[model samples]
Target: MPNITVQLLAGRDINQRRAFVKDVTDSAVLTLGARRGDVRIVFEEITPDTVANGGVLASEDDSRAEVVSRFVPQASS
Candidate 1:
């Protein structure tokens, strides 16, 4: 059995995530000789504030924050 855990910023659509999971499982099944049922994929979504880069909070870094913010939908005023 293969257990894969992916941690990423919380912004992707449900369909995107599902497709990624399916692709990963299919690759494992073909390349690793693992059964579809034995391949496991887990996704962990976190906010930019919860992640950091180069010892600085992601929210505090303009460049990093911009990248993460792009994935998040803009809120209506």
Candidate 2:
């Protein structure tokens, strides 16, 4: 059995996870010779407040604003 762990900031939808799981399962099945039933994938979602990169918190990373906007809830003006 092949177990995989994927971690990312929260807010991605079920459709995104579905596609990701499908592709990863396919790769494991083809490259690792793992059976479809034996491939395990786990997703761990981290909130922006809890994740940081280059000493900058994800919630406050200006350089990542565009990508972060997709996940962060936007308040109506």
Candidate 3:
């Protein structure tokens, strides 16, 4: 069995996760010979404020503003 853990900032849509999971799972099956049914994938979402890069918090880093802004929950249609 192959266990995979993905960590990313919160607010990603289901479609993004679905596509990523399928692609990664396919690669795992082909490279690791892991059974599709036996592969386990877990997602650990973190807030921008909880992560840092180059000693600056992601949420507060000016250079990352655009990227972090995507995690903001959008209003419904």
Using lDDT as the measure, the top candidate is 2
Residues 11-71 of candidate 3: C-alpha lDDT, one tens digit per residue: 8999999999999999999999999998899999988778999999987899988987887
**lDDT of every model, 2 decimals:** 0.86, 0.90, 0.89
Pairs that clash in candidate 3: none
* Residue ranges of candidate 2 with Cα displaced over 4 Å: 74-77
Model 2, 1-77: lDDT tens per residue? 99999998788999999999999999999999999999999999887778999999987888988887898676588
Decreasing lDDT order of the candidates? 2, 3, 1
| TM-scores for all predictions | 0.84, 0.89, 0.89
* Residue 46's lDDT in candidate 3: 87
Tell me how far candidate 1 lies from the true structure as C-alpha RMSD in angstroms. 2.1
| Clash numbers, per candidate | 0, 0, 0
> Over the stretch 1-77, how does candidate 1's per-residue lDDT look in tens digits?
99999998888999999899999999999999999999989988887778888998877788785777777654578
TM-score of 2: 0.89
